[model samples]
Target: MSDLRDAAMSSKAWPFEEARRVLKRYQKQPPEKGYVLFQTGYGPSGLPHIGTFGEVARTTMVKRAFEVISDIPTKLISFSDDLDGMRKVPGNVPNAASLEEHLQKPLTAVPDPFGTHESFGHHNNAKLRSFLDTFGFEYEFISAKEFYESGQFDEILKRAVEKYDEIMAVMLKSLREERASTYSIFLPIHPETGRVLYVPMKNVDAENYTITFDDEEGKEWTIPVTGGNVKFQWKPDFGARWAALGVDFEMFGKDHSTNAPIYDQICRILGWRAPEHFTFELFLDENGQKISKTSGNGVSIDEWLTYASSESLAYFMYLKPKTAKRMHFDVIPKAVDEYHQQLRAYETQDTKARLNNPVFHIHGHNVPTSDMVVPFSMLLNMASVSSAEDKETLWGFIRRYASEASPENNPTLDDAVGFAVRYYHDFVKPAKTYRAPTDQEREALSDLATALSSEEAALAAIAAKNAKMGRDDPLPEADFSDPEFLQAIVFAIGKLKEFEPLRDWFTAIYEVLLGASQGPRFGGFIALYGVEETIALIESALAGEFTK
Candidate 1:
């Protein structure tokens, strides 16, 4: 292992440390194929949403981390359960009546309600692939229907049929008494209607690998278990897929956690071990309700990409996957800003710190040195104040503030500028509120304006004089070259007595400038937006222009 990977493996930080643990476990019992297989599953019952993106992005992060510490080749399978039956028409999809007509039919057999692709399942699968491709995720896409029809799952299906009694015993142990008598591991497909029938199998001929079942019309038939003749229930299929694909690792949401033990037992019955599993909390909306694709209540992948970068979304997923997080439009700006911050930190931090940073994993250990001229939050403030409709206007301010920075040299910042503009228009504009500063706060603000006029004025000196500030650690000598110096100034300003709680003062400043009650850190905002422009904004607020 390289020194950097060695250091990364040593750190107890999230994914890298988790990856090391997984690698060590694999090392104890190496795969026969000499490679690790990571799987992220998608159910094709609905269009791909942000939750789908999160699973793939997070799994990719782990896979990338695994690649760094070990030479074991890794492959990620983006598997789609397209053969699943459509139990009900999704509330968000078009043509609900048409979808309802196909209830209980295989997703692949149902027509696309939107009239877009060959089948409903095909439409969803194509969408899933397109978005994953858009993010440049490296994974092999596999459809359950294709695997079943192509005989890839034949061996597993036969094994399941032969072990039907054992599988049923495992499945029945956890079910309620009322439902246990009727439950069967196999769900046969009716040849006449092409619908996946839920009726119990009347008889199973293990030697012939055949199951007999009656269709909806009471017509009885027997079919071979192999060659797409039957499909296993979800729990059994989960176990069978693990055995069939040799899945080394798979992560899923907590809702399916209860099924893990059952799947493990089923896999054991098949003479194979279950893959290393991770269960994560589900994504919730701002209202604390679960985010669902069918409900269409949460942000979509396309919506996020419209206002943020893929890296931002990836970073959002990287944080505390075990804890449920509210994912909505409101979370986008912070995620975008944090992604930029991580990139900036990656450029300056040491290898150990870089390993802990999200950008290091988000880029798969190839952490990019950022040329960010300004933070995203600051760009949003600029967008709000200037009402910049295009990149040219934003670049005009960027050029004036950071003479060395330009769209040509700082592509990431340039892209962020566009995102900030869109985010402001969509999310920030509607909720903006400007509260007039109190007399005491206005006087303090005027002092800040006077200090800005001096070419050599320091933020620390201004803060100390205005608020009687004291710190256990003595302030460093004023050096404009240090970014932390600007942060300190903003920190001190926030501590001023004029705005008693600091949040009020922060709100006052943001309200005066952007008509918003909260915004980017004031020091960074001033540095990127220019001292003169900010002074003018304060003056404009005092003059009552912003209130109008």
Candidate 2:
């Protein structure tokens, strides 16, 4: 058996475990279709956002996990609810005034403001497809408009018509007294204004699958239940789609959690079971405010791609997806670092342990080897310290630290260095803070700078000083790869008791090197960025050049 198959069979990772649960549930009562369908719904109300990418990326991960464990043919349906009526113009899109002219019309019928597609819905749908395709997600795109217009939903529509009163009862139980009176499962598209009408149905011809409703002007009309003549209300529409499409698994945001029971009831009334549902919390901003597109308070997909890789975004989505996560510029470096960390871990972990690692699942069990010389956070600092304009400068430091590392052998790190350069310029450079060093701190920094000629000689000097002070742990033989060396430097300086607060010594180092009070672990930074370069940076800071 293949190594991946062996690991998957023996490991109890969450994705694999979830897949097993799904398979067992199906085995107990299998669908007539014999395969699973995973559906991800998108509303083409505005430009596809980062949240949209998260939904698809997460679903694709589960789908990949399912593929690994089972030979059952599976399909992911990227369904766009483009037939829903447009209530208002989206603030972010172009030509808001044009959209206002067609208020309440089905989105598919509204004219495209960008002139890139046939209609507003078509334009947004194209964008959604293009965006998902850019990530190379395997999904079949389905449009609600085309699904209804092509008679694909005819059978389910007829069933819903026959059970309209039963479906209405299920829907009305959840509504207030006032709303329950006017609620109708069927919303007929007005033949005159071409808008979806919410007016009460005059009568229902259950025998013939037809409904009679009055237009806004009180003109009476009757329409067929199928062929896009009518669409169900939101709750029933969700249920009808589940019944019609035979969706086996699907997920939505937590905002829809309360509606799940109602949707399930509606589905049962329509003679179909609701798909297995997973509700995930919404994405939040860095300050923990909920990200809302209308509020313009969160990052966009294009913005994230400007500074990080798509895989980094995927890694962000992979962790505890059911819990809310902050998606902002500040989260990028950590996500990139974690992605690289996982790649590095995958190289040395045993088969069972590898299965538990996210990179194993993120790459669909085909974890590729990497020779990353440094973490992303360190590279970001390196770029900042070196003022690197491009990859060459970052690579110079990389090659100095690890002579064998190169762009050709470590493509992931090479790409990350480029991203780090862009991120440092865009986010880090503007917020940098540098402080002038005190005389005593300056003296210590100067002494450290002299040792730049040989890192070992500097370690021995610090060790001898520590021994003279009768400290318990003196500096050990220099090994930059181990963080203990840098920690020892901080500890040895603290033993001098020059500063009241012991942390001040480390803080001094960070402020001098990064112009920030906190940064990458100093030892790791020096190891990856070379001792000579680190000494030069400290000397430059002491010379008042960095403060300028």
- Candidate maximizing TM-score: 1
lDDT of each residue in 356-469, candidate 2, tens digit only: 888877787567675666888888888888878999999988887788888888887888888899998998888888888888788767766665446665676577667767
Q: In angstroms, how far off is 452's CA in candidate 2?
A: 3.9
**Each model's lDDT:** 0.82, 0.80
How big is the positional error of residue 424 in model 1, measured in Å on the Cα after superposition? 1.2
Query: Lowest summed lDDT over 10 consecutive residues: which window, candidate 1?
Result: 454-463
C-alpha TM-score for every candidate: 0.91, 0.91
Separately for all candidates shown, the number of backbone clashes (residues 3 or more apart, or on different chains) is 0, 0
Model 2: ten consecutive residues of lowest lDDT: 488-497
Model 1 CA deviation exceeding 4 Å by range: 25-29, 450-497
Model 2 pairs whose backbones collide: none
